[model samples]
Target: MGGELTWGLPVILYLFLAGVGAGVGTVSASVLLRGGGGGFGGDHFRLARIGALLSPLPVIVGTTLIVFELGQPSRAFNLFKVINLSPMNIGSWLLLVFICTSVLYALAFLPSFMPEMKHLSDRLERVRRGFAWVNVPMGIGVAVYTGVMLGAMPSRPLWNSPILALLFLISALSTGVAAIILLRAIFRRKSADPATEQGYHQSAYLLTASDVMLIGFELMVIFLFIMFAHLTIGNMKYAVSIILPGGDMAMMFWVWVVLIGLLLPGLAELAYVLPRLLYHRHYAAPVAVEVLVSIGVLIGGFMLRYVIVVAGQVTGPMGI
Candidate 1:
């Protein structure tokens, strides 16, 4: 069979990018809302503001790229004209919701500094609070649906699994949190408020800590998933060949996907954690490490979707 996947690189990358935006955007919104007096008024609050502001742009652009994938852009109306339980159907709707919510979330933050919007911003904040409730579940649903879109097809042995959605969902959260931490770190170093510096550092550490936990879980799932697929003696088992011991895509899967993407970030996180846990040790990673970890996580997150989408399609169809 031809090595054509239902979803192509553009769509897959689009999916990964959108999930990151939604996850990070929502996290930024929530962080802003949660920070009380010291929160928005403090220097760290500015970082949160920046995160909430910057995080949504990628998602908006990614959604547009997904549209450009069509040979005939005008026919895009066909999608809106039909609705079903299909994974793609669900994903499209979720993207629409995520896009709207993210925009509102970012705008709600304008009043914190924008003097012009101060009046409307108060009411916008209340609306945003309502959306905050909506964004969490919606963002999570979009992340998981990305994998579910690929996983729903039983014919693609490499894609079908309960764990696929779980992996995507967690990756979304990890990237989202990472974006916030990295953005805060950069902004803090550039700013001149001692209070802001401390706040940014504290926020970065907390978000990074959460990211560390999620990344660890994603690693374990990958291990168990490969093991489970390898042990089974059937089409499902054969799918494992693409990445396990030896296969066509093994190098991409192992080195870039696993090592730089997952391991580097995971190890960076480990380095930051181990000294403290075992020896009462602590180290403030230089800005370079923080930036590297963010880049690594983002790459890993996208590569995962790429691998899942491409590898699943490259395999023979059901060995029929």
Candidate 2:
């Protein structure tokens, strides 16, 4: 490990924001495809519209941050000059392609805003559906690439585990759901029409249910990550100790990443979801609760990246 950290907040933010965008874009595309790609005017597709519209910007901003972090924005173009199987090269291209496709995918939904372009909107709806398929895999690739970038560095044993990718992917999805849930809670209109209101509730319920599952998977992956590292010999075992009990990063990992980020949100969501799923009660979580839980998840997601990036650097450049 180095005494001075090479990567700082911008890199950490890049990881978090990129994963969020990937998750949002992926989930958004799936939602649209599930609903059979219609104009965004209907209540059912509101979630999709929100997701599509929100997807690209985070990645764009995150990418910009990374470019600035590099200190020479013009040198960024060098990534494209030589294409290979390297993680950085692949990630740069993946980010570029994803931004383009997601932006176009978002634009397809915007024609609905122009009532006079009804015919254009209808035509683009078909294109939107096609883009949905592409975005799903592209989004996933971007999400996994973030982890892959870290795990590729074997000297950083804490980041060397294969499970890191899965953990990041699941976390990304969870945070994506959280972001969408937060947005819906904030922007949702009080429709006089019962059907429209009901649709909103339904979307909320679905997002909650999905987040619960993602949180559950993230917890399991965390467990596996710890066990995997602990079981390994020498540098790997020593490296992972930072996040274990009594280690340097133990409190941050347990408190921020596990407890606040995962458990509270997961339990809260399950509580809300169970009543609706079992007893058929109307899904009406308080807006405050929704906002808090989503924020917690997002916080947790950021902390996870912070902990991992820092821990990897602080631990040692293991002797090979």
Candidate 3:
């Protein structure tokens, strides 16, 4: 492996999952704040509730994966010692703060599920609303930090681009929307009130529309990332080669990341959304298609992090 990374799958998974955690947290907070005024079990509340519930799990799991992958998991806590300007220092604190706020945000939804806790709903709503403000900036920090952590690794030219942070941030939000849609679809299998059901479909449409635009932006960022590297000389070009036509990770990047992850999902969402927008009618696609789109987005998100991590190692600094 020489001077290239000893880091591997665990690191990639950590990046993907961390982005998911941050993404969902941001979406959950935003939805809670902007959606209609309704009580705990109302249509508007269910989606946000699901998102809040999920926001913490991925981050905690990703953090655990990285910590355990270290030879000594206990030493992971040593990161707390330095609170300086370093990316690691800032990211460490960011992740810690995000985890704490996300947990509180999730807990704030508890009263919604418990009829016995009805009296506490108002107080919980206030707490949850307060956390939403905190979650947005923290979530963005966490998402951008994942890429910045890689960008800080100058020895790996592929990971050193300034655009990587924005790319990951966009992907994180896209995947987060997918995750929420997937969960909402799964949990709402049984029939409900027509109005509530209509609201659910409408919400999914809006989210899908947003995700399509995000995917478009992601594709542009990726192009810029490649172009930036392709224009450089020597090792930088070598790094870009890993994802070009015959490069080692070409199939993964072009086929999985670009095709399945970004393009297909965007087209699928657009197909469903364009008609609804044109006609002013509330509509959603078949459940199976939505499921596939969500799954594809998630698979694409995972492949992106994996390919970037692996390719960065395969084409890195010249000598051991």
Candidate 4:
């Protein structure tokens, strides 16, 4: 662990952004499919449309970062020159296909905003949904690939956990949902129509509840990941220790990833939601609180990736 890492911040950002894109893209696709043939312009499709529209932006940015990190842009094109089972090769193809499909998926929703495209957009809804079928799995792949890419690094014990893949996927989905909720909160503010406003309130509650469940699952996986490493021998145990109570990265992991990212969001949502469910209240949580939770979740999500990437590189096989 002496020389500079071939993979660094750019890689981390790529993973983070890609995961966000995948999570949101998958959620958007699910929302559309469940939109009940309302097509893209329907009021119910609004939130999901935000997800669909944003799905590509982060991914595109992440991909661009990856290309820049590659030094020679044309080298990316070389990935297609051969076909092997290598994670790099497979990931390149998966990302390429996903980007293409996601672009189409995003474009198909254009009529939702552009009136001139309504006729064309109407016909493309099925096509968009069809793309969703591919995008959802592809999004999952992109998310899991982020972890697999690290886990594939056999020398890095911290990245060796099988749980990493699942952890990354769960985090991706949680952040994705949080991003959508944040955006909806900002835009919808207060719908003019009572029925629409009420619908949004219910949807916000459901989304928050769903995020709480995801945060729960993510915490479980994080525990399993740490325990799996802690219980192991040699480098693995040493790697896990980096984030343990008094370990080097301990404070960063506990304070940021666990407290702010996972717990706070979970507690915040429960505080707002449980009372409503229990007391049958009709009011929504304050927009500021909801937005704060979303921001915290997204920040926490980024910190998780940063911690893992940096710590893994720092506490590797002792003589890398």
Candidate 5:
């Protein structure tokens, strides 16, 4: 097996950052929708506002980085020029749509921040409300598209799993939720209501729990996927083995992707979730656990894209 060692960095970083950005954006949207009396306590408007402000920064940066990685930036124009049904074309269109919607969504979030713009912000909010109807689906489309982009590539064993898209979507949601939690922790000190603070913490904990579970599901799918790929007869199996412990990207696959990426986060989540079962008012411990878990999950998310992108290009079509 032989290939250049170039495709690794861009593909992995793009996947990780894209998922991170979109996930945060989507979570902020969800927080806004379920805010007020319906879900957890807090000035949901305020928290949502903060999340909205911060969400797109990462998405925009991630997208730009990805464009850079695609080699010649000018060639990306071909994506929109043609409406072919290829995944590349579809992803290009989907990303364009997602970026536009996310930008609108993120911008619509600014009105509540300034007194002078309050009235205008309200109008934008109304407009954003309408946009939300479209944005939600588009957000999901973007998250799922990350996975689908890889899954569509049949030639690459590591990218062939149908579950890959779902995994990426889940990762996006998890990191997004984590980002909000961290943001709330970092801010909300000045005028944050006690009830709201407690509620935000709880909501953060609950969502982190959900993220942990979803990540578990993702890991299981990955396990099944690798096993499926390895059991197959031919290049697929040959390619699949290229990252197994002693192979080309072994350290990345096992240490970064598996342990730090998946295992540690899962365990950290358990560290908090289990405590809740034993007692209540356990906010400090659990909250701390959630924050730590978020960091781990974010790292794991990065490793996932890194391994898949790097490993796919490493092996020959089949074992030579």
Candidate 6:
């Protein structure tokens, strides 16, 4: 374990941002599909609009960071030169296609803001739907690829588990949901129309509920991650110990990733959600609470990547 690490903050940011973009794109696509003939405007599809408009920038920025990290901007194109089953090659292509499709998907919703594009946008409705379908899997693929990239390195026992990919995917989604909620909270307008206000509340409720479920899944996957490593023999068990109680990364992993990232946010959301879900109470949450919970989840998400990336490097090259 050295004081200096090989892969630094840039890589961690790349992973976190990429996951967020993918998650946002996937959630946006799902929301669009769920709306059926509702299209991409109005109170009902506000979340979709937020998601579609927001998904691509983070990925593009994250990808740029990786390119710079490579020390040669042109090196990135090498991945696209040949097609292979390698995770790097596949991820390169997946990211390229996803960026293009997500941008086009966002364009489809431009009619909402630019009235001049309404006619052209209307003509592309079917194409827009097609992009949505493509986005779901492409977004998912990018998310899963993040973990698979790490897991592919067997010498880094901390990242070698099969469950790692699932963990990353779930975290990506949870954080994505958090991003959308945070944006909605920050920019959300109070509709003077009661019906429209109710629609806004409903959208917030659904996003909150979806995040709660994703947090649950992320927690479960994390538990399985720990158990998988703990149950294994040799280097992996030792690697797992570093993040367990009293271990090197114990406080960071438990406090940041579990408590802050998942539990507190989960409990807060469940508190607001249960009344609406069971007792039929109003579903409105204070803007302050939404902001705090969303920020917490995003912080936790970044820390999770930080800990995993740093820990894998620290614990490894496993006596080869």
Model 2, 1-320: lDDT tens digits are: 35878999999999999999999999999988885335656645889888999999899999999999996788999998999999889999999999999999999889777789889988887898888899999999999999998999778889998999999999999999999999989997799999888888888888899999999999999999999899988777999999999898999999999999999999999999999999999998889999999999999999999999999899965565
Instruction: Tell me the tens digit of each residue's lDDT in model 5 across 1-320.
Output: 46676665766777777777777767667666655412222445655666667766777787788788877887878778889877767877877887787788777766656778767876676665665566667777778887887777666767777877877887777777667666666664534566756666566556666666777887887787788878888877878887775677878778877788778877777666666756754544344565676677777778777777777766546543
Estimate the TM-score of every prediction: 0.89, 0.96, 0.95, 0.93, 0.85, 0.96
**Model 3 misplaced regions, further than 4 Å:** 1-5, 37-43, 318-320
Point out the higher-scoring one by lDDT: 4 or 6.
6
Q: Which tens-of-lDDT digit does each residue in 1-320 have in candidate 1?
A: 26456679788878788878877866765665575413335534565567668767878888888888888877876777789999888888887887887777777778878667667766665666676677777778778888898789878887787788888888888888777767755664456876655565566665777788888888888887788877878877888788875787788778877898778888888788667557865446678888888888888888888887888887744545
List candidate 4 stretches off by more than 4 Å.
1-3, 35-37, 40-43, 114-119, 276-280, 318-320
lDDT of candidate 5 at residue 131, scale 0 to 100: 57
Candidate 3 TM-score, C-alpha based: 0.95
Which stretches of candidate 6 lie above 4 Å from their native place? 35-37, 40-43, 115-117, 317-320
Error of 5 at 24 (Å): 1.4
How does each model score on lDDT? 0.75, 0.91, 0.87, 0.86, 0.70, 0.89
Per-candidate RMSD vs. true structure?
Answer: 2.7, 1.5, 1.9, 2.0, 3.1, 1.6
Judged by whole-model lDDT over C-alpha atoms, candidate 4 comes out at 0.86
Kindly report which residue pairs in candidate 5 clash with one another. Answer: 23-172, 23-176, 24-176, 147-165, 261-300
List model 6 lDDT by residue over 154-273, tens digit each. Answer: 788999988899999999999999999999999988878899788878888988999999999999999989998989888899888889997899999999999999999999999999
For model 1, the superposed segments whose C-alpha errors exceed 4 Å read: 1-6, 33-39, 42-44, 115-124, 190-192, 274-283
State model 5's lDDT: 0.70
User: Sorted by lDDT, highest first, which candidate order results?
Assistant: 2, 6, 3, 4, 1, 5
Q: List the candidate 2 regions with Cα displacement exceeding 4 Å.
A: 35-43, 317-320
Question: Candidate 4, after superposition: displacement of residue 22 in Å?
Answer: 0.8
Pairs of residues clashing in candidate 3 = none
**Which predicted model would earn the best lDDT?**
2
Candidate 6 residue pairs that clash: none
Clash number for every model?
Answer: 0, 2, 0, 1, 5, 0
Provide the lDDT at 198 for model 2. 86
